[model samples]
Target: MVRAPCCEKMGLKKGPWTPEEDKILISHIQKYGHSNWRALPKQAGLLRCGKSCRLRWINYLRPDIKRGNFTEEEEKTIIKLHEMLGNRWSAIAAKLPGRTDNEIKNVWHTHLKKKIKQKQDSNNQQLYVTVPKCDDLSVIDLSESDNSIIPALPGLIGSPGHSPMSPQPSSSDLSTVTETSGATAETDNIKVEKMDSSDMFFPLLDQDLWSEAELAENSSMELASDSMVAAGFYSNFPRIDDDNDMDFWYNLFVKAGDIEELL
Candidate 1:
């Protein structure tokens, strides 16, 4: 069955309702009640459609309809309800006493939407730390000045040539320290022995290991290969596998002032 249009009848009045029309609609509803909105206007002797008369009474001339600006609490309630209910204006209006769905919808478009957008933009903004660039690493100073280098590792402050008050060692000084340190030679011998025995010291950062396209195509195979390389490196230092154990050993070397022992 086809539904008849509400305003299909010809010669029916439309547009803004007059003060007299509002009075008649209010009085008619108060006396006879609006049991049937589709037949209300015809019975009340108004020159408007039943839909028009119904809107006039419910949206405008209802006795309990609240007027004037919405309060701060009401606006907050509308925001919360909108987040949960979305654009169901009628459902949102039911929570706010005497507030119409049309009024709440108008306020959302004109005012609330811009406020929400601004808050989201503020939250999404990224914070960047600016690091000063230096072309000459040899000329860089590490003194206790305003622009002094802050150590990232815990034991770097007490380490040789990396102290805040000491000047950084030159390339010649680094080579001399490497040649004289007995513990450094022992550590190197241990690494060489392991490489000869198991052949586990293959370069994990080789360019041919896995391309970006290959990684995207087969992530599981690439991950397994990467894990095997990582296991080989971790196997060399069984005691320093976790952060706490690593920190303990590093701090011990720093306190003893033996950089060679830390090698």
Candidate 2:
């Protein structure tokens, strides 16, 4: 159902409002207040639609309007508010003094959106390192593979005797998995299938890139998959063994008390 135009059949002026029109609209609004916008133009003696006059008054001609560039703080505020509120420009504008919804929407589209896209593209390119898996499939994303394999490292921590090849906690099982400050449950079910052990060691998540220095100082650490790998820690450690003696290796890498350190 298409609605009728605000002033389609009426010969009311449109486009940019001139100084004479601005003065007339301003004088009328100042004296009587904008109580009835649809009847304002005739009262103000301007041949313009009420919609156009109201938009002009609110967006540009308003006395408290801030007409210059947006400050850094304002830009950050807009971005943060947008993440929570989505494209509700009017609501965002309400938080920002002296900015109109139309102005904020324009800045978002014209400048800020492109800046955010470029930053995301740069991050995606940086995180995407490809490792050669086999002769058939030349390379795959390292981060993608981390989702399936456990990282082999010096400070690794996990539940001993749990096989790396054991399935990850399924979505249904996560509800049963709980965390306490310093307790490890046997039923936690975190496991790793022992690998050839010579394969590359990557951080389980992207954020584990903290320096071994930092890890040494801080005994308790949490791992995130989307984090970057720490510098110099990227080198592969000597493969502990090749035999199927899985329990011995699992114990060395994964101890119940310190498994959280593996991150």
* Candidate 2 error regions (>4 Å): 1-5, 132-263
Residues 179-236 of candidate 1 have per-residue lDDT tens digits of: 1123342222110000121222222344333343443344443333232222222222
Best lDDT among the predictions, by candidate number:
2
Query: Can you write out model 2's per-residue Cα lDDT over 163-192, one digit (the tens) per residue?
Result: 232233433332211233343544332333
| Candidate 2 local distance difference test against the native | 0.52
Off by over 4 Å in 1: 1-3, 126-263
Q: Would you list the C-alpha lDDT of every candidate in the order shown?
A: 0.50, 0.52
| Clashes per candidate, residues 3 or more apart or on different chains | 0, 15
Question: Can you give the lDDT of residue 205 in candidate 2?
Answer: 32
Candidate 1 yields a Cα-based lDDT of: 0.50
